[model samples]
Target: MKLYSQTFKDHKIVFIFFLFFLICQGFFSTKIQYERASWSNVPKAPARTAYVLSFLGDEALAHRVLSNLLQNFGGSGGRFVAISDYDMDTVSEWLFLGNSLDPKSEYLPFLAAYFFGASQDKEKLRPIIAYLEEVGVSGGKEKWRWLVQAVILARFELEDTDLALRLANKLASLWRPGMPAMMMQMPAFVQLGMGEKEASYQIMTELLREEGDKMHPNEVNFMVDYICTRLLTPTQKESDPLCIDVP
Candidate 1:
């Protein structure tokens, strides 16, 4: 009983000191930890400002905005998806500004256009392609090539063949020495888009004749078979004397 009383007395003294220390510290110190999101005071400026800033040697900022836009479109995920119309417009405006500021920046505009073509609606692709053409006019060979790649993606992946063909023809007309011969395929695509399968077949036939020796045997055979298949549909073969046989 005496030992227990002494232990109680010791604990009471320690508790009183602990309480006193806490009170003393609490009076002088204030600790507040809560969930607060990071905030930036910098406004998301308008495209005009962004354009002006980029034109005035702030190209890095433009790149940053482009990067942020790409992230929003799920570009970081390796497969971009369509965004809302308003967000698309915002991203497009920023892209126009960025490309307009640095016409020679092939990668940014090329990537933006490719992602846009993959993810954007057909209604908006026309203006985007027009903008790319305008930029390609002054963006030199490398830029033009990249823009052409973006158009091809739109053609095959986005099913926007008409727009892609239009851009392709424009790029072909502006052909540089290093430009690939694939640009010439635009005419075939144009014919296909217009429901003129015969014209497309003729174009493919000419391509095979002109480039057959240069292409791998397998590739050549593939092209010939593809053309023949399209030209020699079962229903049309009976009446279609124009069907050219491959082999």
Candidate 2:
């Protein structure tokens, strides 16, 4: 009977302790749910070489995981977080790290260009633009799209036409076989935006002469019309063969 009594007491003690734990857990959970939440800055990227090595040399998996984490970091905990609230420097680092892990994946660049690139704080876009530019330059023909995106973000989002022109020029210089003709014409378009009519004319003229056969009919017509209507005076258009009969 004494042993039985002792066993019952032990069971009762465990039950009471478990009940207390539940009560405390519920209290803390309720308090935490009601507590004011603040936006947490994005964490700094880990050392690239070490991080990849730690993933058992599966760099692809490492970057994929990082990409997912970055996408979720902004909207974590079911909270609405603005892009402006992010620490762009750290975000840039994270993106760069992701790229280093998987240079071929466009996922990180897409996020850099569209997601965080939409920040209302225009200045914060600089790092993102820089990141995209690096990806474009290093990625070469296969990754030219990132550079194009960088130019767009610089021109429209940041309203920095000079920087846009510089990027456009780089993109034009890097033009390769099989690249879209429209993309090759970015420099001329940017030049026109900056009111450099002569430069734009020269670029378009060179493109038409060298790659006109590769361009679609609509693209060629668009270029001809733009050059004739926008870049040249009526007198010049009348004499220029490319502009002749161009409406």
Candidate 3:
């Protein structure tokens, strides 16, 4: 009787330990599911620039000053703002008088591009990109942080998925020393395109085990999985992860 009781106690201890381990693992995995996306930090600009501009500069003076400069200057912040054809001993006043960067300066390129050009010309988008890039926000949250998103949003807002995808691909390509975002999400696209539900999540089983997109190292694993999930077909029943070839 004593021997049986001791053996039963040992079995109970082992089962308790096993349960504890499983519980810990579950909590840790759940914590990972709610992290934020790296792209979320950056965002698109709103259509409220006129208010901002009016608050920052003399609205009337700025407008009047902009009109004269554009007639001849082409762009406001080019190297020669003061010289009306600087050191023009052979000439006179500049036909255009755009914005300057400093308090005494103006913002012609930004103004002209944002206020007038962006709607009619896709090329106008370059200045926004260029401004972000020049300000050293190409790959970070501070400056170019939300630039790609903004570009994509612009394309989408214009009802142009083609442009949005083009911009997304470009940014993802420049994932800066890494694979394109679409490639990693390729399985999802493939699953959705081929109409597979189980296969979609199956790909996640493998990817979740590995490290995530290298370029955007800060990416949340579950979020990556979520993106893949977006591509899953809605019609299929759910099940355990399968051994997908990802072909």
Best by TM-score: 2
TM-score of each: 0.48, 0.71, 0.23
Kindly provide the TM-score of model 2 when superposed on the true structure, using C-alpha atoms. 0.71
Tens digit per residue, CA lDDT, model 1, 1-247:
3555667665687899899999988865654233233322212436666455654757666666665654454333344334424245555566666665556555455445545654445555655555566666664644554455446445644556766677777767776564556556664655465544564465456555655665556655655565556455766554544344543
Q: Count of backbone clashes for each model?
A: 0, 0, 11
Q: Which 10 consecutive positions of candidate 2 have the poorest summed lDDT?
A: 191-200
Computed on alpha carbons, the lDDT of every model, listed in order, comes to 0.56, 0.80, 0.37
C-alpha RMSD values across all candidates: 12.3, 10.3, 26.0
C-alpha positional error of residue 117 in candidate 3 after TM-score superposition, expressed in Å: 26
Between prediction 1 and prediction 3, the one with superior TM-score is 1
Off by over 4 Å in 2: 1-6, 9-13, 36-39, 194-247
Cα misplacement distance, residue 111 of candidate 3 (Å): 29
Instruction: Please give, for residues 1-247, the per-residue lDDT of candidate 2 as tens digits.
Output: 3556657665787899899999999999988885545666797888988898888999999999999998988686668688898999999999989988888777888788767887989999999999999998895435776787788778767878999889988888787777667567887777666545665576568667756785457657866886899779999999999987796
Candidate 2: give the clashing pairs: none
